[model samples]
Target: VEISQILLHQCQQEGDETADVGPGGDYRARNKLLEHLITGDETWLHLSTAETKPESVTWKRRSSPVTKKFKVQKSATK
Candidate 1:
């Protein structure tokens, strides 16, 4: 029971199906639930596979002794 508690129980069952709609419900099932909703920057969170400019090249050996190149950021909470 973990993928973040099944995505918080499917986002609390889609917030109780949008709080069961209202004022007499069913406008074609609320426009088929807002026409298949998909925004969050159109969604794509692969989360990992990054280094591939020749696997982030790093083959120094002409007296190899100079290391400190940390500057690759992307995640201010998505």
Candidate 2:
């Protein structure tokens, strides 16, 4: 299951700027894209170190509204 297509899809969905700066960084997005490419499903990829191979890459699934946490709530007590 090659995820290159999926990675590309996600990149398109996220737009170049957001995808580039998202969460961890460019490396994070690359790893995430790669995971989706390999698994054919959404997944996360963690880099063990700062070093990375030029060819290696990944991407993350477009976060959902719930996942993004658009709202804030105060604690309630009686």
Q: Per-residue lDDT tens digits of candidate 2, residues 1-78?
A: 466676677767765342355565643333444444443455555433333656344455667333352344444432
lDDT of 1 by residue, 1-78 (tens): 586676666665665343344577744333333446555665444454468789777889989888786876654333
lDDT of each: 0.57, 0.48
Q: TM-scores across all candidates?
A: 0.23, 0.21
Instruction: In angstroms, give how far residue 64 of model 2 lies from its true place.
Output: 71
Name the regions of candidate 1 deviating beyond 4 angstroms. Answer: 1-49, 52-54, 75-78
For all candidates, what are the clash counts?
A: 0, 9
- Any idea how many clashes model 2 has? 9
